[model samples]
Target: MNALGLVVEYNPFHNGHFYHLAESKKETNADVVIAVMSGNFLQRGEPALISKWERTKMALHCGIDLVIELPYAFATQKANTFANGAVSILEALKCQSLCFGSELGEISSFLGANEFLHKSKQQYDELIKKQIKTGVSYPTALTNAFQELTNGKEILDLSLPNNILGFHYVKSIREQQAQMKPFTIQRTSAGYHEQNFVSPTIASATSIRKSIFSNEGDITNYVPSVTFQILNEYKMEKGLLHNWEQYFHLLKYSIMTMTEEDLLTIYEVEEGLENRIKKNILHAQSFQDFMERIKTKRYTWTRLQRLCTHILTKTTKQQMSFINDSQTAPYIRLLGMSSKGQEYLRSIKKQIELPIISKLATFRHPLLELDIKATNTYNMIFEEPLRSKLLKAEYATPPIRL
Candidate 1:
């Protein structure tokens, strides 16, 4: 079977995602689509609006053939690291192509830009150093470097989040010498953060999430009916629906309890960021307040959010370095899959390079340890029956097979 791979965090699997999945299939003409998605925490350093199980069910319910979990370590990093892990999984799975949505849809243009960025990498690095010295943000420095190197060519615009991630996806393929072709579908209608519905059929994931958060507006107009229904069910039955801020106490407690040495061990808590966190944790009222207190021109809010997440989960620099130095994922953790997906996995089961974990019965690994801890940390938000059940579900729940 020709399998298509997608790097996704279908936080709620809204209409935009449904559109992307359908378009990716049409673009690739693959027999099955395999999605490596984020778990409870996302790249933005926030808890997912719903549980991964519900998100997987939402994807499978819509059109996805298979869903895999992008481990907590990789899923919560920047665009480059996030793309690297997702691309590596797709490559290992022998996928024919990677299908994703991006602001820049023209393949030829993106390729040309990719080539220029790769060739001028040294020059770009120097420019980034110079610009950073000038006090501009890293993303801004990158954009400036790209413009300087490309001489007004619209390549590596880094300002657009999707474009930045798309660049890294292509970069990962080239660096790994992977054979999977990349196909980009032009994003339609609303912008990445735009909250208003541009078209009923096409809306930003941000807008859908905001609507769900506020419990206002008709989200059914933006998501599939089944997705809405699942959200409703989880909202009422489990009282588990959440945003990032809900876990402030957990994050606060984690930061407050850790010493300087302990904080330094965690990934991204470098260069006295520990002290900044320690100082702020005593006074900051909420996660937003804490982040704002810690954020500087050099460290973006998202970066701080991710760092805070690392502190909450205790993903150490040593653990990250081990994964980096090894240049391989520890395992392939399946989240959910449809019947077609199951058949596809069965066919490739013998050939897969890493362990394919369907459940945590006897699993014992540092990476999986981080994943479990991440869930336990996220579950701190729930009260009573929901809290314990959420914690147990990670170990007890099997991959959704539909």
Candidate 2:
């Protein structure tokens, strides 16, 4: 069976995701659609609005054939690292093509951008470093470097969020020499980070999440029936949607109690950031306030959030350092699967490069350790029996079979 792969964070499996899933399969002409989805936390360094299993059920109900958890080590990293890990998992699954939604919407543009960067890698690196030295954010430096290199030529725009991730996906595929062909579809209606509704039916996940959090507008039209139902069910059962603000006190406590020396050991804590964090922790009122207190031109809010996530989870530099040294994921963690997905897995199981892990107890790895820890930390936001129940579910729940 031919499988098409997607790198996703469903968050709540909104309509935009539904469109992407359908388009990906149609574009690739594949028999099954497989997704490498983030677990508990996201690339932007925020806790998922719901649990990974909840999101997995959302995916399965939305017609996704398979869902594989993108381990904590990669799920919360920068775009390139996130793409690398997701792409590697897809490649390991023997996918025929990997499709992503992007502003550019054209695969050629991503391919060209990757080729250009590969050819001018040293120059681009120097330009990025030069821009960074001037106190600009890393993303700004990247945009400036890309502009300088392209010099008005129509290459992929690195400034757009989806395009940036798309470029990285293409780059990773090339770097790994994977067989999967890369494909892109134009994102419809809403931008990746747009927090306002742009269409009646096709709103960004950001907008969907904001509306859900604020309890303002009805999001029924913005997501599929399954998504709406699952989201409501999750909220009813879990009591609240997960968010940074919900975890702020614990994060504050973590920062307040840890010594500066100890905070420095957390991944991404560098150049006396620990000092800045210590100085700001006492005065901040909320996660937003704390982020504003520490926000600087050099460190993007997203970057800082990832740093905070690391701190909250107590993920040490030593642990992440080991992960960065590896080229590919150590295992493929199956989160959920439809019957078709199971058939595809059975077909590829013998030749797949990584171990296919369905049960947590059956598989062990240094990376899996971080995933478990992240789940534990994520569950901390819940009260009493719910917290213990969620934590127990992590080990006891089997992969969802649709």
lDDT of every model, 2 decimals: 0.85, 0.92
- Model 1: which residue pairs collide? none
**Residue runs of model 2 more than 4 Å from their true location after superposition:** none
Candidate topping lDDT: 2
Poorly placed runs, candidate 1 (over 4 Å): none
Question: Compared with the true structure, what per-residue lDDT tens digits does model 2 show for residues 128-232?
Answer: 999999999989999998999889687878889999999999999999999999999999999999999879899998988999888889899999898888888
Clashing pairs in 2: none
TM-scores for candidates 1 onward, in order: 0.96, 0.99
lDDT of 2 at 176: 91
* Residue range 192-247, candidate 1, lDDT tens digits: 87877778677888888877777677777888899889989988987657786788
Best by TM-score: 2
